[model samples]
Target: MWSGDELDLDAYLARIGRPGGSGAAGELRPDLRTLYAVHRAHTAAITFESLDVLLGRPVALDVKSIEDKLVHGRRGGYCYEQNSLLAAALERIGFEVSGRGARNRTRGDSLLAVTHAVLVVTVEGEPWLCDAGFGYQGPREPVPLGRPGAEVQQGEWTYRVRKEEDGILVLCLLRGGVWRDLYAFSPQRYHPVDYVLLNHYSSTHPGSSFIGRVVVHLPGDGVRRALVGRELTLLHPDGLAERRVVGPDELLAVLDREFALRLPERDAAELVRMYPAGD
Candidate 1:
């Protein structure tokens, strides 16, 4: 179970720009409206990045470590940290939250390992797929799990969950009139320990996509952007993607401006030093 009691709920809420008080805290009830609001605010405020992994630092899954780095420190994180923090917040709000390990399906025809971490939140006895960590292509709000193959529109983006023949639920996105598979997850409940193991492989394994790379993504209503290595790609709802190369001199600025991320002076220098060597 997520350590909701251990999390500083107010701090987490404030970090996402939703201050927890009589005004806002009163609205943080365990319901669909609060779930959608929190999920949207989180994805809008915190970016998706693998800077710690690229810096060779251990990505801790604990609520404290994640709160320190992401909430207090004003830094971003990958799936585990993002969804873990979210799950903790929702759980603290008296919502039913669970974990699910998902396999990345956007890669190709080859099946990949179960590395992605997502959350399942139950509201009024109905489960909703609440993911704030799928990068630029992720959902901004909770996608209802009760209705499969139903189009759920979050702003201009369209997403749907299809039930495969094997009972697996695959999340798909509509891009340029095509339904592209984003990732697939099973109903098997994952725990914090499971994420710790998945985090190890993703942060250390040679085959990991995040290793030796500068990966950052920001999801938006009009445009979704991702910075992979030196190339920066902007994706639109119509499936039009524009790519451009980012020079080393502009790296930090791009992260700050585009992703709303600014590292410390020391970390900035180190990331700049390692930027040229990235893939």
Candidate 2:
């Protein structure tokens, strides 16, 4: 279980910009509308980033730590932190939430480890894929798990879930008229301890992509932006992407202006010091 009781539900709801008492006499029902609203609000408000990993800090999965860093501190986090906080909030709202480990398919055809953490929330006996992480290319709202290969439109972005022959469910996006796989996961369930183990490798291991560089993503309604190392890419709904290099001097500004993320002074200075200058 995700320790929902330990989370500050009111604080979290406010952090995501969801007005209190909006759901029928000040109670959040565990229904599809609530699921969609909470999921959308979360992805819209919180960004996806791996700064703590790049800063040599531990990424804690506990709900309190997650709430402090993300909800209260107004900072962004990677999959483990983002989804864990979201799972806790949803669970606190009386939704049936579970965790799943997913493989990164956008990198290439090579077999990758199951390192990504996602959540499955059951609303009225129907399972929905509620992922608040996965960067800019991820789905903004909850995707229906019961219906695979059906297109779900979220603003300008379009996404679908395809069930593979091996019983794996792959989340795909329609980009530039082509179906692109974002990530895939089996039906196997994961737990908080499992994420803690995965987070250790991602935050410390040299083989981890987030170890040596800065990566941040903001999946806006119209424009999805991703900053990897010094390269900044903006993805449009029509499948057009614009790329540019963000200089070290402008890194913090871009993060604040574009992603709405402002790190602590010490952490920001350290990030600039560790930022890669050469290609």
Candidate 3:
């Protein structure tokens, strides 16, 4: 079992833009309000990005390395790194948190791998789903896990979780006047080692989406901003989208300005070469 003492809870919370973390008495406790505050701060502060993977660097999932990367380094990461860091922060804050894997079913059944990592937290004997790693399309707060269905509203988006057959839980996002399945998972407690295999595959595999393209996402006050390769899309709260093609020369500027990423010169050059806007 991982303990919260291993991480600097105060530093972690501050890095995620939640300087005032946890209970008022100063001792971190397992509570819904704290959970929501942490989740919201993380998603808004630290972006969900795959630049390292695309740049041919090894994506380490160890707690120390993850902390350094996201906190000290001020870099963003994919699901495995993002969720792992959050889980560690929560665990150290006295929350009974467990790692879980989920299969992204948004594309189709063709991609059936446990590539997503989420946290299942038990506070007061009740389970809550907390994920700050699912790009910009996840619940903005910790959602309660229950039977039938539960809808959670975060600003302009509505997320639904429903119990499915064979003890599977399906998470869906409401979009375009329809409910789209985001991912599905079983009620199994996973650990950091469980994500090692999937992280390697997702970061290094030629078929992995995170490898060939540059994906950067940040959720804001009333909109979600995403920069995929050469396309920049701003998604409004009402499910409306506006997109435009960004030139190769302006890509790094967009990354720095909009996504708040200060990439190294080498990585910036590599991205330009890989995703040139051939106008």
Candidate 4:
């Protein structure tokens, strides 16, 4: 029962580094320009990380807690927290937003569960996809929603919206000339409570990958940086990439300097333990 009343519009804007007023006093519309501005700014400012999950803390999906954690607390989170915060902000910004459940195809092809979340927004009677989550695979700007075979190319990344035989829509990424499925979702609407259940599973279940791994992602000027259990990768748009296994001693500095996170001493020490050297 999110009334969309809990978000602090001013604080949220500051958190995303879009603190300036959008325009004159007129009500803002969900136009393409505004959507791109918000989406890109949100993705750039916030990051995709699993610090709470890694530290064995509960993940909150409510609007108040989300605002407090992501906006006021100045921290990053995974899909549920990230998209939930984005959806709430978009609603307050006057967008026709629908929260949808999805399955991560990267995890497997074995009839995956709805472990991911995304937003389908309508602007001027047309649907567009916007997500601040999805880490390195997230779009830099909102992409038009289309049927199978339709594609949107942002720099080096090529994303396609494909409709499966069962009428499920999947977002695919083209990498190294191969089309890899990112996630699959139906038009089925999802609610905040629904995400609470999904979030609990993702954070607590022993089978969940987020339970023990150190995953951090932040989009840079022209590259996406990701750290997965000490293996740091920098993927550039021009097919250039670099990777190295980072040591535990440098993990905190990387999180602070590279990802722009200011973690508490306890959290920082715990993260170092979570991703120890040679892990």
Identify the candidate with maximal lDDT.
Answer: 1
Please estimate how well model 1 matches the true structure, expressed as its whole-model Cα lDDT.
0.94
Q: Whose TM-score is higher: candidate 1's or candidate 4's?
A: 1
- lDDT, model 2, position 244: 97
lDDT of each: 0.94, 0.90, 0.82, 0.81
TM-scores, all candidates, are 0.97, 0.96, 0.92, 0.92
C-alpha lDDT of candidate 3 relative to the true structure: 0.82
Q: lDDT (0-100) at residue 272 of candidate 3? A: 82
Which tens-of-lDDT digit does each residue in 162-265 have in candidate 3? 78888888888887677889888898888888889889899998878887778998877677888887789998767799999998878889988888888767
Question: Which model, 1 or 4, shows the larger lDDT?
Answer: 1
TM-score-sorted candidate list, best first: 1, 2, 3, 4
Worst 10 residues of 1 by lDDT: 19-28
- Model 1 pairs in collision: none
Model 3 bad stretches (over 4 Å):
20-25, 109-111
Which whole-number lDDT from 0 to 100 does residue 213 have in model 4?
Answer: 82
Which candidate leads the pack in TM-score?
A: 1
lDDT of 4 by residue, 1-279 (tens): 344567776678878887545452134456777788888889988889987998899998878888888888899999899888888878887888888898889866577788888888898998887888889867777777755678887766788888887678888877667788889888888888888899999999998878788889986556778988778899876656799988988888888887887787788877777776664
Model 1 Cα shift for residue 128 (angstroms)? 0.3
Give the winner by TM-score: 2 or 4: 2
